[model samples]
Target: MKNVLTYACMILMLTSSFMVNAQLPSKEKQYLLDFNKSTHGEQWQNKWNLQEDPSTWYGVEIKDGHVTALKLYRNNLKGSIPDGISILSELKTLNLAFNTIDGELPEDIFLLATLTSLKLEMNKLKGSLPQDYSKMTNLEELSMFNNLLQGEIPNGIGDISNLKTLNLSSNYLEGSLPKSIEKLHKLERLELFGNKLAGAIEVDLGRLVNLKELILSYNQFQGDLPSSMATLSNLEFVQLQGNDFRSLNSLLRLQSSKLAVFDSDDEFLNMKFGANEANRTRLVDTKYEDTKRN
Candidate 1:
């Protein structure tokens, strides 16, 4: 009887040890630990306390025992994002915008297939965008505006069929707009102003039937405006300043029936589209003025 009791106690101790070990090694926990240490998370506006349940952490949302979202916008998070972030297989949204986070964006973060919204805008992040953006098929909104990112826009970015709003403005990105961009059937707003991008705008832009605001001002774009743009029935604002555009007659004709906004610097209008009443009338109402020009 004494031997049996001792053996039973030993079995219980071994089972408890197994349980503890299994619970101690969580990928999500490790991700947080690495992220916190790597980014100086202790200094964040809403610092995370690793001692407590991750669900209770600030800006972190856990669903079904998995981290689903991490929104630390403008949180003063410094240092590069850790590659361990990709371990959050259930993560849907990751917004680290308006922070001091600087360094090349980790390519693995783009591999998060569950991500629907990834906003890292207004950070000091440098380095070229990844060439292979095809892994993020579930992405809906991708905004990386006002960063120090350089290099040509990746061709694979257009593979994100569900993408709606793509804003990469105010970067050092160069190269022509990829032809694959026409594949984004769901895209609405595309802002690429203040870059070094050169090359004629793709004629396939007319394929973006759902496009509402097309902001492509302040680039090195040259060549005649695509006539297909006249087909964009939903286009409300077309900001095309600071570029060497050859003509905008087709775009002006678009303004005749629909309420549209066009840049009205008389000299610029005359130089690009020629002096026409349609251009003047489109400018007179100025209510639809492209506010993003400034």
Candidate 2:
């Protein structure tokens, strides 16, 4: 009778396992299956098995039975991202940087309201940024550098008050910096270098008291540096090379005693600060000195 009881216990355990496996949510299962089919699962450096649970897939993070992050950086993921991924309502971080992923960003991508950090840098993505920034209220870090995106930065971007780092460099974006940018009081680093953005530099930048490093080199920006910028007390580095600026001498008079690296293309501008007081700031035009990609 003891042996019979042991056999029954084993059968019960096997049945429970089957039940657990079968209980996998249909939405999550379909998302993985669709992603695999769309992204050419066979070619991925880290391939996914369609038959297994998505939580077990590489670069996919699951929390509380929901996908929370999809970090597939430098995985050699080619082709466009499947639009089905917008269904991941619980996703917080979506990092697909340093890949060969090409094509326009899916419009539905803006539907991800829970997204906090979206890093798609060093890809072949095209098309202008979405117009409705209000949808991404939780976004903090948006790094989309080295893409083929064009058109003026949408004014709606200022609506994302929580943004801390905004790096849209090395794209084809044009037009003046939006005046609404002053709304980002919490912004720390703003890098808009290597683009075709023209017109005078936005004077509102001085309102960003929390700004640390502001890099706007290799663009078509014109006009004098805003006097308000000298008020920033926490600034450390400011690069404004390869542009049409009237003067940067005002920046040398910043209230921030922590200013260190201030690079530009003008030899005379460099001399203006370098010729004075101990040479504390390293003023030079290193925008094209070292051989490198964007």
Candidate with top TM-score is 2
Model 1, range 191-284, lDDT digits (tens) per residue? 8878999988784878898888787878898888888877888876567778887877666555323435556233654444344456544332
Q: How close is candidate 1 to the true structure, as a TM-score?
A: 0.81
TM-score for all models, in order of appearance: 0.81, 0.83
What is the Cα-based lDDT of residue 249 in candidate 1?
A: 66
The C-alpha RMSD of each candidate to the native structure, in angstroms, is 9.1, 5.9
- Expressed as tens digits, the lDDT of each residue in 111-139 for candidate 2 is 78899999888899998998888878898
Every candidate's lDDT: 0.79, 0.79
Which regions of candidate 2 fall more than 4 Å away from where they truly are?
Answer: 1-24, 266-294
Q: What is the model-wide C-alpha lDDT for candidate 1?
A: 0.79
Looking at model 2, residue 20 earns an lDDT score of 54
